[model samples]
Target: MRPTLTLIAASTLLLATACTTTPLPPQTIGQCNAEPASWAIGRAPDQNLIDDVLRDTGSRDVRVLEPGMAATMDYRADRVNIDVNDRGAITGIRCG
Candidate 1:
């Protein structure tokens, strides 16, 4: 009986893990910009600038997983994640 309970617990854990949602899709600079009106957006900045945005924003959906360009100079959107290069320039922005 104990062995059966353990097996059931293990199976339950596995099923719970599988129910987790997938992470957000990595987007390109052009693709992110094309989406009109996001939840947030940062000003013209490189990828490193995103670190602060991610930390302060408190949203896992915001990730600069790839290199990309800032579509807007105002850094306005529903929710924006900026990716930049070594020179402190924005490569792309994603909105959610």
Candidate 2:
């Protein structure tokens, strides 16, 4: 009985040591700057314009928000959101 208990204790200790957690590597987070893309405001939103906005803002993604559209409240620094009015004209440009 003593040998069995010792073996079990040793196994538990070995398992615990093997389960150690390693620190994760640092990640590069993208930050969007809306100032450069401000030129897109009041302009129509198309694939070409959206691409330009992304390039100008240094954003990883773009979201076009039209009137009455439902959007998540989450803020992402790597995203650019363009708001359009009812007439399909771009109204505002922002970075989230």
Candidate 3:
């Protein structure tokens, strides 16, 4: 009888665990759409361009990455990353 109760408790616990829902990761929520802002590539990076990129890409924030600049590798779905060259021209745009 004791072994039967233990088996029932273990099965109940497993069932509860199986029914639990895991939250979506940050990268999966509010993802930035960079396609609209692809037109900004090859243009100069400026405050206006940054603002436009943010609006167009539906990103909550913007990060300008220049050559040799150190940046964190963290992935943010609501951010737009603008990569520029030494000539100060925008080279690439992406969402992480």
Candidate 4:
């Protein structure tokens, strides 16, 4: 009986932790979808900047693309793509 209770408790704890979801900052498609160019343009894609955007937009994924670079064709609803020019200035922002 003790072993069975311990196993059940352990399983319950594991399932609870696994099912938990961290809350994300609120983001709207109309706003987040239009934010990339203004946020990244004339700015470098540094870690700090990336972290800021990720926090602000609550984006699940971010991809930075340089001029003429090819990216995966699969689209993700939770992703934001930042396109930069040769000078490392952001030129476009799109959401997938």
lDDT per model vs. reference: 0.51, 0.90, 0.92, 0.74
* Residue pairs with backbone atoms closer than 3 Å in model 4 (clashes): none
State the RMSD for candidate 4. 11.1
Q: For candidate 3, what is the lDDT?
A: 0.92
Residues 1-96 of candidate 3 have per-residue lDDT tens digits of 999999999999999999999997655445699999999999999899999999999888899999999999999888999999999999999997
TM-score of each: 0.30, 0.69, 0.69, 0.58
Model 1, global lDDT: 0.51
How far residue 6's Cα lies from its native spot in candidate 1, in Å, is 0.6
Give Cα distance to truth, residue 11, candidate 3, Å: 27
Q: What CA root-mean-square deviation does each model show from the true structure?
A: 13.4, 7.0, 5.0, 11.1
Per residue, candidate 2 scores C-alpha lDDT tens digits across 1-96 of: 999999999999999999999999866355688899888888899999999999988888899999999999999989999999998888888998
Off by over 4 Å in 2: 1-29
Q: Compute the lDDT for candidate 2.
A: 0.90
Identify the runs in model 3 with alpha carbons over 4 angstroms from their true place: 1-30
**TM-score, cand. 1 vs. native:** 0.30
Give the least accurate 10-residue stretch of model 1, judged by summed lDDT. 31-40
Better of 2 and 3 by lDDT: 3
lDDT of 4 by residue, 5-46 (tens): 999999999999999999998765533453644666668888
